[model samples]
Target: MVEVDNATLIAFTVLALLAFVVALIFTGLSVAKKSKLFVNTIGEVSAKYETDITPATYAFGIWNLIFIWQAAWLLYAFGSIWRYADGGPVLMKPDILPIEFYLFWISCCLLYIGWLFLWDREYLFYAFIDLFLLTGCGYAAVAYQSIALNNNMIGLMSKSPVDVTLVYVLVQNGTDLFFSWTTVATLLNLASALANDPLLKRNLSAKSASTISLVILGIMVLSWSLIENTVWFDYFKYVYAWYAVLLWALIAVIVKNYDRTNYNSVFSIVLLCLVVIALVVKVAVYASRIS
Candidate 1:
C-alpha cells in the first residue's frame, strides 16, 4: 500500500466532499428541470395526437421518488468516504462484507432485506436474488417514465414557460432510459459471471456483447471507486485511460450513424462519454495535486 501524510489525506477528503456536494446540487437541479420538461413533453405528445391530458398525472412523479432514493445513497457513500479520509473509521469493509452486502445493507436496505424474507419462505426461490433486484430496478425505471408522461399532461395545460422544462425533460428522460439499459447490461454481466446452466442459452450465446458491456461497466465502477476509495485511485487511473479510448470509439460510431429515431442509442453513448470525461477530469485534478 502507498503511504500518504495526514495533511494530504485531509485535503483529499475535503476535495471528495466538495465534489460530492457539487454532484448532489447538479442532480437536484437536473431533477427539477426534468420534471418540467416531462410535463411539457406530455403536452406536445397529447397535442400532436389530439388527446386531452393532465400533467399532474404524469408517470414521472414516481421517478422523482426514485431519484431521491438514489440521491440519498450517493450522499451516504460520499459522506462515508469523506469521513474515512478525515481520520474516521471506514464505514464499510469489502473483504469482510461482500459487494452485495454493502449494496443491500447500505445502499438498498429495503430490497436487500426483503429478499431475505422471500429466501427464508422459499429457500430455492431463485439461484440469484440479485437478478430480482435488478429486475425491480428496471421496473421502477419504466414506471417512472410512465408517471412522467402522466404528470406532464398537467404541466402542458398550464401554458407556462416550458423552455427549461423541455431541456430537463429531454435530458432526464433520455438519461433515465440510458440508466435503465445500463442496468440491463449489468444484470447480463452478472449472470454471465455467476450462472452455470446451459438452458440459459441467450446469456451464453452473446459472449461478445456481454464481454464488451462488462468491460464498460467495470471501467465505470472502477473510475467511481477511485474517488470513493482513494487507496486505489492510481490503479484505477490506468484503467480509465484505456477505457477512455474505447468509449470514444463507441461514441464515434453513434455520431457517424446519427438518427433522430435512434435517440435512445445516442443518449446512451453520450452519457457514457460524459461519465468517461468526468473520470478523466477527476484523475487530472488528483494528478495535479500530487505533483
Candidate 2:
C-alpha cells in the first residue's frame, strides 16, 4: 500500500479547490451572462442548445447544493489531516481514508475543470467524455464512503454512538448525495450535448437522438432506484434526504416542462416509484426498530 504523502495530500487539496473555484466562476458567468468565451474565443451559441428533455431552469439549482457539499467534503478531509496536531481526540486520521478517495477526488475535480474548458470551446463531444468520467469518479467516491462507514460501524475500539452517527451523517450521506446527483448530472449533460452539437450528429437521425436521450433518462432513473433508494436506505438510516431532494428535482423538471409525448412523463413516474420505495423502506425499518 502506497502511503499518502503530505505533499501529495496538499496537491490534491489545492487542485480540488482550484477546480471548484474555476468551475464556479466559469459556470456562473456562462449561465448568468450567457457567455461562451473560451480559449481565445472559440465558442458556440448557447441558445440553440435548449431541448425538450432539458430540465427546467429551477432544476439547475442542484449545482448550489453540489457545490456546498463538495466544499463541506473538502473541509472535513482537511480537518481529518489536522484535527489532532494540537493534542486532542482525532475525529479522523488521514490514514483511515481509502485509496479510492484520493483517486476519486482528483478525477472529480478534473471532470469539472476539464469539462468547463471543453464546453467553453464548444467541444460537447469531449465534454460528454468528462461527464462519464465524472460519473465514474462519483461511483468510486461512493465505494470509498461505504468502506469508511463500515469501518466506523465495526470499530476496533469502542466509539460513542453520537460520534459514529456524526461521522456517518457527514461522510456517508455527503458522498451518497453527491454521487447520486452526479449520476443525474451525467445524463443531463449527455442530453445537452446531443441537442447542442450538430457536428456530433453525423448521420444520426432525429429519432436516433431522441431515443438515445430517453435511454439515458431510463438509465438514470433505474440507477437512482437501485443506488439511492434501495441500497443506501437499506444500510444507512435517513437516506430519505437524498431521495427527497432528488425526487423534488425530478418533479420540478416534469412540472416545468410537461410534455405528454416526451419521455419526461415516463421518467417522472419512474422517479415517483423510487420515492415511494424509499419511503416504504424507511417506515418499515423504523417500525421494526420500535417493535
Relative to the true structure, how large is the alpha-carbon lDDT of every model? 0.38, 0.60
lDDT of 2 by residue, 1-291 (tens): 345656565566556666667777766665554455654221233334544445566776676777787677667666655545324333433333455566786677667767767776766667778878887887777667565656545441353345456556665666667666766656555766766666674534433454576566556556655554445544555444456556766776577667777665665666567666756766776677657
lDDT of 1 by residue, 1-291 (tens): 123444443444344345435544543443353653122332232223210111122333443544454455344434444444214323222111122222222222234333333322222224235435644554443333333333443443233234224323332333343344334323333433333333344433333433444455556545654553375343222333223333543454344434566543444465566667766676676777578
Instruction: Report the number of clashing residue pairs per model.
Output: 21, 0
Worst 10 residues of 2 by lDDT: 39-48
Query: What's the TM-score of each model vs. the native?
Result: 0.25, 0.74
User: On a 0 to 100 scale, what is the lDDT of residue 81 in model 1?
Assistant: 46
lDDT of 1 at 226: 54
TM-score top scorer: 2
So what's the TM-score on candidate 2? 0.74
Superposed Cα deviation of residue 138, candidate 2 (Å) = 1.2
**Which residue runs does candidate 1 get wrong by more than 4 Å?**
1-128, 144-159, 163-171, 174-178, 194-291
